[model samples]
Target: MRLLTRFCSSFPQQTTSVGARRGGINTHNTNRHYNSLNASSSSAADQVPVLDPSSLSPSLTRGIHVFNCPDEVGIVAKLSECIASKGGNILAAEIFVPHKKQTFYQRSEFIFNPANWPRAQMDEDFLKISTRFKAVRSVVRVPDLDPIHKIVVLASKQDHCLVDLLHGWQDGKLPVDIKCVISNHERGPNTHIMRFLERHGIPYHHLGTTKDDKREEGILNLVQDTDFLVLARYMQVLSANFLKAYGKDVINIHHGLLPSFKGGNPSKQAFEAGVKLIGATAHFVTKELDEGPIIEQMVDTVSHRDNLLTYVQKSQNLEKQCLAKAIKSYCQLRVLPYEQNRTVVF
Candidate 1:
């Protein structure tokens, strides 16, 4: 938005010496007159251009802009032309149209030179483009800080995964803000999870679930204030309504390789199956359980001596790594949803 100008210069010098000896006084000045002449001559050479932010016009900030439009050749062409006219560049985009919805969504990063065009004129130009394409627009500024993503973690009586996340956040290893911790079970008021939250000053919500709809209600309430959701070993299955309400905002870390040991006791199931590798998957929450778009997945080799306990340990480690990676990708806006999955640009 603001620009600064810099200047550099070089100056020549001369030396003069004055001394008094026993028999005579000696004085010497070499090139003194020449140095003064040269200094005067080079006075203009030291002058540099000055840039005043207040005197100049403002420029547009860098950010991402999302557009939802119709899936038609004419519409796409018109959109592209409009963007180009406004000097907007498309960095990355994905188009998804299922069935006859006729809806087209795109995410693009563009540079808005506010210095060239005033803020009002810039908005006016974008408004005209939106009207021409009959689209909805949303702009997100490029984060200037540490870019810590706000994550609302949900857990039910599980401490290992939640503890790992806590430690990661505390050590600055995970660029995340744990907005709150929601749990379905009441492990007293002084449990490990509660104590960790207290230590970090993060809010902890204990939404005890009893009825069939209780879990859904609690999860929905917790997600209301969060930018995204992280299910860190939450054993309960979320209701269909909850998943639809949150859409792709929810991410789950499954302790087993997806499309294989999906349900319960996945580690034991893997060991029983004599699988050579044990791993974890981090995926978006969809209508179908464990079938959402996979953001990240990792696996570790397993030997014959690996028992159920060893497999669980390995799986937990993999789960933390995969989930953290997925969260980081989401925060960086590098994960894009495609047909039943996601494309991680980074």
Candidate 2:
């Protein structure tokens, strides 16, 4: 994927008299960056260029692009040639191709001097290459150096998952802007957790549920300014209307293997069923409760001695890990919808 450029020009000259001319050129470079970073083709090798990063500006914009092609190795070489030729440098890349599938997939990040090269010309050049390779999909964006995605986390009483996410955001491990943290409980019995958010200058919304639709309404209002929602063990079941309103914009982490042990106290259910494995699943919220498409999952082995308490503790750990991964994927634009599931094109 290549970043395409859009340009705008303005003239400040009067057109009344023939000799009354006095206009200066005003140009605006509105370059739209493409995130799909992949290249293919037998002759693409001619496009790659070699560059020294030290020669470029310190504040360079970065972007990722992906391409789907069966034989991408040759294309990768060609793409490298193109970037090198244009004084652009590839920072990172990853490729994937299933054994039974004939198609190929690739994700690559690159740095370029937008001031000099601009996006429009780059897009045109990339389109020529894409046409030759018959690329499937492409996306491009300037990596958000400062808060990009606005996220609102909803939790019932659990603090482990929420706490981990908060820490990740504060430390810059997760690239997102956590607009607020909404809970059905008033900080529960854990005052330390409340202090943590306050210390970080992060706002907290404690709208305790009461009458009918109160919790739903509160959540809807809180998330009105947010781009995405994360249900970090937010125990209440969302109504059909809520699901329809948010749809794929909401992500939930369940303390169960999902499609198996769903609903209240999943750890207890797994223990009672004598299952050998207990796990956690992170997925998008749908009208069918835990039946939504999964984004990430983690499992842990259990023995007969493991009781409900032990299983719950283990599942909590798994939940924290899974939810964090899912959130990261969303911020990076790596997760894509694939039928009733997700395709994390990492």
Candidate 3:
């Protein structure tokens, strides 16, 4: 079965600007120019404020709970009632009902004194509610200083997206603990990407693949402990069985806007098609290649003057930006899967 079990959604809508950080350890300072806190009002009914992960503080943030079940009345009311009984304050909530499927999806955040609402007890109590609705649920307790999501990045020879993610983590831009970097390509021992990762003390693993190797077995072992997997332009095609085994939390950055230009050599395809707008899509990886639920998408206008090389360069930049944005949203607990093939990201 295709499971939609994942974390809650919605970051603060308002965030302070973060200037680009210069390279090298001497230039990096954690205190200089932190992003603004992404706190929301006490009521989930109010508009959600945007949150900058760099600006979060432990005293002000709340925990998010994601729940989905067969559509019926009082799911929200009952859940809210339970939370209220536990002295939890609803900070923000997003709910959706896919009419055709008769299913409900909800992501809600609440502030409660942990001393009063212990996680173990809360889970025990919530289980009854879940069973009553035949629900599937996940709770992500996000403390201000904690790295709630752990990521493992998969890359190939192309390191643009991988480099972007690494730098973002180092500069305190993306709110995730990068567990490690895995690459199918040997790329030799002295590649620039290897030197850069080693300079920053990030773990890098090279798993060279042969045509007959059981590559997926090794990958599965590596990612078993990770919360999510990121395909930072990894060129290998994974089988449907592999996707199912991995729990389907994998996020991939496609260089082309989906449904228009898909598969290899998208830039060349777009150039031949003479499309005016070129774009990138970030989505959950599924068995059906490039057809997974999309989390975020971005586009850039193209002109006749732009040749294939120029388009490639510009689209590479877009790929980095789009993937980073989607990763941030995923880590912030603001992405929700809904309506079979769609996602609702707040």
Candidate 4:
């Protein structure tokens, strides 16, 4: 808990096509990038971009833009104008201006005739406004027109979250290409998972680690060319060096409500504490263990009648949904980094 091949946006990317071990065996890439626009590439005179007939959406296609920049007057007007100028209609806009903060955060969804506004031109338009606002983060995505995110999952023993993610991918509820699954533990209790990965042609790596060596090099080699990593209850703590090397976002699911029962066997910790509430937390992975910004959380009621196994079961169920929902949100371009260790998950 770490991923980019950038095209001027902050989100990580891969090919329009995904190979089996490269991401998925047969993931659906329904929308091909239709760059039919025959425009000369130039912003010298700041003219409108010419549309490519091939890339044109026969109907209005939805586009998403997430921006974080310094707050100032006329920001909204400029944003509106940027889209409106290109024959795009703003369907919804959400802006967050934190109190006593210089930061400005916005997530916008709009519909545009791709014939009038080419994909490349949209990027240029956003780039111009982003530069003017001195933005720290800027990303625009047309889910129907761009590559689906490619991700790798790291787990140790527990396959609840991992299994759920696999099912989600299969059901198409989670729009992603799972490059592979990496684990430092044996498949002793996870034989079915092994069979599933084998049958589906999804690569699964079993790299054993010890106190002397966490097998960082092997993990890095496997994770190369990925958009991001998911810690599906990957027990080991990822080192700062590994995260720095990867330089992308890492999402992890904590078994218990974070800041409460962190660092191993949280179910037992919560049980010992006699707490009535048990939950799971999905968040960005930082070098400081579970201290990263939370993206999603889910809770379930527990009482004295509940036993340790019951608590564990409930936590596992929550973890599966929490992690899956977080991944879905991230892939939809609905997540953005905000102020220190916090996120603007629209």
Best by TM-score: 4
Over 1-346, each residue of candidate 4 has an lDDT whose tens digit, in order, gives: 1211111123222211111112322223321211211223465354443344356566888898888798666676787788888888665565555545656767777779888899999999999999998988888999889888899999998879999999888888998899999999878535889888887889988899999899989999988888888999999999999988988888888977677888988888889999887888888888887877788888899988888898889889999999998888788777766546566666
RMSD of 3: 11.1
TM-score of 1: 0.63
Clash pairs detected, candidate 3 = 9-334, 10-334, 12-49, 12-50, 12-51, 13-49, 13-50, 14-50, 35-55, 38-51
Per-residue alpha-carbon lDDT of candidate 3 for residues 230-329, written as tens digits (9 for 90 to 100): 9999887777888778875888999777766777778889888888888998888887778777888888998999988898898999999999998887
* Candidate 2 least-lDDT 10 residues: 1-10
Model 4 stretches with alpha carbons more than 4 Å out: 1-58, 188-190
> Which prediction has the highest lDDT against the true structure?
4
Off by over 4 Å in 1: 1-139, 145-149, 211-213, 246-248, 340-344
User: What overall lDDT goes with each candidate model?
Assistant: 0.61, 0.67, 0.71, 0.76
Residue 29 of model 2: what lDDT?
22
- Residue 241 miss distance in model 3 (angstroms): 3.4
Candidate 4 colliding pairs = 3-248, 23-179, 34-55, 36-52, 36-54, 36-55, 37-51, 37-52
lDDT, candidate 4, at 289: 78
In candidate 1, position 322 carries an lDDT of: 86
- Per-candidate TM-scores read 0.63, 0.71, 0.76, 0.81
